[model samples]
Target: MDPEPRSAKGRRTRARLVEAGKTVFERDGFLQARITDIATEANVSHGSFYHYFDSKESLFREIAEEVEVRLVSMDDIAQDLTESAGPVDRIRAANKAYLAAYRKEAKIMRVIEEVSRYDDEVRKVRSKRDDYLAARLESAIKRLQADGLADQRIDERYAATALGGMVAKFAEMMFIGGARFDMNTAVEQLTYLWANALGLVPTADQKVPAKSATA
Candidate 1:
């Protein structure tokens, strides 16, 4: 493992190298990407690259960790919504945010997924990311059940795992697998499925606002 950069300049150089690694890895893939390419892209010396990362794989791991942070933060869309937002609206917002973030990072995500198939460490990182998301979803489902908004009969853990996997698979298919579909329609359909699965229904007094059809 490489030592942490203590100085501000060292931190900036490390961050630049990480960003450069992402660019090269997305363009040339993990097996084909080289430390020289990353160093060149970052406008840093080859020795500087070693100062931050022991190898290209180490740099790629750091990049994957950063991607996980961004993907996890996208889940906060539901929490950022107003209290009056209906279940369907919250689900839609979260799905939209997740899908959008996934799309933005699709290239790197594809590389990560490919590498995880054979690399044990990378696969562990991928599993950790999925587990974190599923745990959050489980908590949200439990809250819905407690509020009498979702089905109490459903097991929160299993429901969360299944539902979260559904959205993730859909995202992989659409963004990574090159499947074409209208973004707005995809979000609406995902929201409908998620709500129906949880048996979510708004009370008579809960007025759900209209949403734009435009993506």
Candidate 2:
């Protein structure tokens, strides 16, 4: 790997290369992306690409790390809403935030997912992101249980893992697999399922009408 650029111009140039690499990778994929295309996209010489990154793989690893950071940060943003929201509302907000982020980065995320299948470094980064999300969900579940909102009998770890994975896979399917789903409906249904899975009791204000027996 190249040393971090110190000068302002050098840093800008390096940043451009990274951005260009992402575009090229997303366009051509990991196996097909070339340093020449990245340099051309960045408006830099082929050798300049080498001055910033050792190889395409190195640049991709950096992007993968960045994506992981953004993903984890999205989770944090959702958690920030917890203090003011009820259980269902909080879960709905989290799902909305996650799905929005996934839609925005679907192309690059698809590339990262494909690369992680064969690249150990990328796979580790992906795993680390997943673990962080699961940990946060686990903590939230425990809090709900402690507050007498969620069922105490459920194992937090298993529930967290399952619920987190469910949301993630649902996002992947809707965004990457081209499954057509309305965002509002998706968030509502996911929130409903998550809350019910944990046996969350709704607050009085959130009560819904009961279905008739004939219906």
Candidate 3:
């Protein structure tokens, strides 16, 4: 169900609550952060918090939802793919897109990933987000097939999972380990990995490259 309409000011007030709650949870974790802290952060009463969210868990779920929703968009991805100079560029765009989203909201992503390790409720939300990302990758793969832009040798679904798994695992590692990973390295390594796996041969026009097939 949609969130009930409040006056614009009231809606803004509730939004602040959700946003603040998300920040706190990302900083302190799902179990550690309290609704009272969120209430104070939002400049709302603890009573007013109930008016917006049923519980802290529900607010955390919403934060996870917001982060996952930004991960992939097949529609935008299609444009990036076609406009790319070659398959290598397309692969880079795909990786860059994934990593960019990951880096943009790594905090909330970490919260969702970390809490999900122990909580069934959080697991459900994380599963939903994974499903959504998988669906988008599947769609993007289907579009590539239809356009004759991608090779038919590989199963697009399988390729999507393989590719998605690589980044997903990397992000999970970043959440777990103290690492100096950055977006550029993710874009470069993931693109190289995907391209080499796909047996893609890129020409000079492609901004970066994987080495020759027989080399």
Candidate 4:
């Protein structure tokens, strides 16, 4: 059944709540965040918060939904792929887009990661997102193999899992392990790794330059 329609003001208030929820969750994290904190952050009353959300968990799920959608929006991915010239280019584009989104939503992602240890519902949400990204990478790997652009001996699914885990963990380490991450360098190296793992040749544009004799 279709859900009941909310008035314009109701929609605006819910948006404010969501924005405030993200801020509160990012600052305080899931374990430390409270309904009152989100309500205060939104400048809305406690009753209003309850009216829109049954509990903090529901609100967080909503935020997670938004984050996942942004992270792997097929429309955005298609645009990125469309502009790419080859497998290496496509991989680089995907990495750049994922990294950009991860940087922006790092805090919330950390919250989700931490809370998922004991929260089954949250863990499921996280797992679903991971699965979606992995599947996309797996498909890309298969395509490369089909075109004779990648190593036929590589197991597409396992390779996809490894690549996805490496990128996700790298981003996490940068945020929580105090690693100094240079975005451009990280993306370049990651692209190189992906290309090498698939046994694909780098494009001429990606080739390393030889030192000049004068030097």
Candidate 5:
């Protein structure tokens, strides 16, 4: 059956709710946020919240999915890395993007981390994210090595897997552990390892620089 005309409005309302929910989740966190708060923030009837989402946790899953999407879309970072810069620069830019996203959304991100502890659904979301990111890193690593920017000495698969793990750990420490993880430190650390691992230019001590972007 053709859907009601209100279906479009429903979709719009749902999108607005998700967007508002993201801000609220980012502000107060998913564990702490309430349906009333989201409804109030969305300026919708409290009952309407349920009409759109089964529960607050389901709403959070929607938000988490969007966040995952935003992370992967990152046109500026991916383009600057892939289209504008060489393979080594691509790695550095990608690292900076991960850290920047983590820093900007630390609270909502903490919610994801916390929820993953006991919730299988949240864990699945996280697992999917990790797998997608790992595949991307693996492909990029292979591409770089094949293109001669990376060192053939290192196993392409191993380097990609190791690099992906390092980036994930770096985000955790930097955003969650409150470490002194700045762009410079990220670049210096990754660039050094990447250059050596890939047998690229700049030898030792040369760090890859990324063009600055707004947070």
Candidate 6:
């Protein structure tokens, strides 16, 4: 295993390698990506690759971890679903942030999904990451119920998991499946579906926000 970098420049170089690894892995895949290629892409010495990561797979793991972090770092949407914001605004904010983040990392995410199919380590990382999202969504659903926005009888866990699945699949279909998708439409429709499914009744104005109907 590689030792931790103790200097600022060292840390920067290591981060560059990780960034390059994402590009190389997405372009060449996990099986075909090489340390030399990553080094070349990062404009660092080939030996420097080993200074931070023990192997290509280790680098891949780090990249996968980064992707996982991006997937759930919904700081823009905030987690207080029961905040003073109305259900419609909250739904729009969360859906918009999630879709935007997914679009930004779509390529690397596709690579992660593909490699996870046959790599146990990658699969575990992906599974854990997704479970975290689902758990958060489940909590949010419960909050909605408490706020009287969602049906009290709805099974939060299953509903959250199913909704999470639908969103992920829709993103993959649009971004990874090479389909021409309108992001505005996706966010609006998806937000509507989620809000309605949770039993939230939209007010006349909230039923279709201005931006929601544009696309």
Worst window of 10 by summed lDDT in candidate 1: 206-215
- Where model 3 places Cα greater than 4 Å from the true spot, the runs are 73-84, 143-151, 207-215
lDDT of 2 by residue, 19-101 (tens): 99899998999999999999999999999888889999999999988877786576555555746678788887888888888
Which portions of model 2 show Cα errors greater than 4 Å?
A: 75-83, 204-215
lDDT of 6 at 137: 90
lDDT of 1 by residue, 45-139 (tens): 88878888899987788788889778878856866588878777788888999999998999999999899998888888888888999999999
Local distance difference test values of all predictions, in order: 0.87, 0.87, 0.73, 0.82, 0.73, 0.84
| TM-score for all models, in order of appearance | 0.90, 0.90, 0.81, 0.88, 0.81, 0.90
Compared with the true structure, the alpha-carbon lDDT of candidate 6 equals: 0.84
Candidate 5 lDDT over 1-215, as tens digits, reads: 11122677887778778877887887787678888889889989888887788888888887787776666555668555435466556666777777777777777787778778988888888878877887877787678767767667777667767777787777777777777655666766776676666677873444455644422
What 10-residue stretch in candidate 3 is worst by lDDT?
A: 206-215
Angstrom error at residue 196, model 4: 0.6
The Cα error of candidate 3 at residue 104, in Å, is: 2.3
The better-scoring model by lDDT among 3 and 4 is: 4
* Model 6: worst 10 consecutive residues (lDDT sum): 206-215
Q: Which tens-of-lDDT digit does each residue in 36-107 have in candidate 4?
A: 989998999988887788889988987887887787763454676654488887788788888888887888
On TM-score, the leading prediction is: 1
Number of the candidate with higher TM-score, 2 or 5? 2
Tens-place lDDT digits, model 3, residues 1-215 = 12554589778987898789988987888889999999999998889888878888887877777777777652355666654366677767777776666767778877788878887877887777677767767776677667676676878778877777887887666544556565566667777777666656556654653433320
RMSD of 2: 4.1
User: For each predicted model, how many residue pairs clash, with residues at least 3 apart or on different chains?
Assistant: 0, 0, 0, 0, 2, 0
The residue ranges of model 5 lying beyond 4 angstroms of the native Cα positions read 1-6, 78-84, 203-215
